[model samples]
Target chain A: AAGVIQSPRHLIKEKRETATLKCYPIPRHDTVYWYQQGPGQDPQFLISFYEKMQSDKGSIPDRFSAQQFSDYHSELNMSSLELGDSALYFCASSPRGSGRFGYTFGSGTRLTVV
Target chain B: QKEVEQDPGPLSVPEGAIVSLNCTYSNSAFQYFMWYRQYSRKGPELLMYTYSSGNKEDGRFTAQVDKSSKYISLFIRDSQPSDSATYLCAMSVPRNTGNQFYFGTGTSLTVIP
Candidate 1:
């Protein structure tokens, strides 16, 4: 499989500006996930989409939102960014109900909120 | 309390030495346990996964889960310098809502030649 693909491998934004990142899931996979990893920390769950509908959201603030397209592509949007928002963002894909074996991840997008 | 806890160590070991990594969780409902390895400035890669309580081995890596104690471990045999990286432990409970995976702060490992 070609695996998950993410766009804009690196991003820089000024405080209060908006940032958007994109992801394209592997072919035939219906579940997409987003995660954030700060320096020296583990990846934290952000949200997931399955069948073009939001399936779950983690402890992220309201400023963070995501959408899945008809083609199984996904986007993560950050509004009114703050310095603390700087981190690496990852997108992953998996087949529905496949449990642990379904998971496949993308190289992350590093964001620096100045 | 955080659902999962792990010792974030900059652990250094010699090549060919055995390495052990561990994590503890407070959520008794978790039934799926996993270990991931991440290189610096890259995405985390799945290493091993287990359901409930048991041991799973792949190549030189072994994963053990103990549901009764809410503990899990990953052991690396004949460790190589290429094994140097951060190890993260994660678990998930059965659910269709919200992010199911809960992760611990990773433990950093360095295998010295």
Candidate 2:
């Protein structure tokens, strides 16, 4: 079974720089969700898309933007990064028929801003 | 109060001991309950899931849901060192246009051999 895939397992950036993260959800999955987890904290929902359309939003910062492409893959673009933006970014996918248990997460991308 | 509450315990126990983790939520609208295990530097993986209420068991893991109390529990019997990880509780309403998940702070557990 293919799982969600996130690019740049580890990322290092300087404050005020920009970065972009990519996510490839499981094949056949329609919904993709993005989450950010800080040090020793629970994962916070950032945003979500269904069928390549923006479906929901969460605590995502104004400097960050995301979009799901026609291929069902998604990208998160962050600009003017800050130290606080350093965290683990995770992507999860689930098909429409699959319930909440269907959420399959990828090996997250660890972002470190200095 | 937060939507979900869980004790952030660095619980240490010897191997073969039973491990119990718990969480409480404030939303009655939630119908699906899930438990996820996260290893260091890895994303969370689903461990158990329950709908509505009652008890569900799978091998060494058992999950109990008390809808009336808005409480859920995960019990690992005969725990092993390999079972050591962070446990997170998540709850959500039925799947709809915009399904959102509420999570607890996660409890860290360590089982020593």
Candidate 3:
């Protein structure tokens, strides 16, 4: 079975720089969710999309934006990055846009802002 | 108050011992409960999930949910060193909302040989 795929397994950026993180959810999965995990902290919900439409929002920063395309892949765009942005970014997917069941998560992207 | 609460335990137990993990939530609307095991630097892998209040057993793992108490638990039988990892409990509501998942802080367990 195909699992959620995240690109740029590791990233390093200077403060004020910009970056983009990509996610390819499992095939046929229509819902995508983004989460940020600080060291020793639980994953925090950022944003989510269903069927290419923004469905929910959480603690995502104003400097960050995300969207899902028709192919079911999603991108997280961050600008004017700060040191606090350094964390692990995870993407999860569920079938038929229903998290009522559960989600399948990606390996995650480790972003380090200096 | 936070939506979910769990003890972050660096628990150590001997091999072959039974391990128990637990979490509590404040939301009464949460109808689905799940437990995930995450290895260092890896994604969280789903271990078990239960709807409403009941006990579901799979292999050596058992998951229990009590809606009335807003609590959930996962029990591991005959633990092994490989089972040493962080266990996170998660829950979600029905389809009316975004149905996003809320997670616990996680408990780290180490099985000694």
What DockQ does predicted model 1 obtain? 0.55
Superposed model 1: Cα runs more than 4 Å off: A100-102
Residue-by-residue lDDT tens digits, candidate 3, B1-113 = 88999999989999999999999999998888999999999989988888969899999999999889988999999999999999999998765446868999999999999
Per-residue CA lDDT of model 3 for A74-106, tens digit only, reads 999999999999999999999864567779999
Q: What's the lDDT for residue B24 in model 3?
A: 95
Give the DockQ (C-alpha) for candidate 3: 0.72
Q: Between which residue pairs do clashes occur in model 2?
A: none
DockQ of each: 0.55, 0.69, 0.72
Instruction: Report candidate 3's interface RMSD in Å.
Output: 1.3
Candidate 2: which stretches are off by over 4 Å?
none
Clashing pairs in 1: none
Best by lDDT: 3
Interface RMSD, every prediction, one decimal place: 2.3, 1.5, 1.3
Give the range where candidate 3 chain B is weakest over 10 consecutive residues by summed lDDT: B92-101
Show the lowest summed lDDT stretch of 10 residues, model 2 chain A: A96-105
**TM-score of every model?**
0.96, 0.97, 0.97
Tell me the lDDT of model 3 at A111.
99
Interface RMSD of 2: 1.5
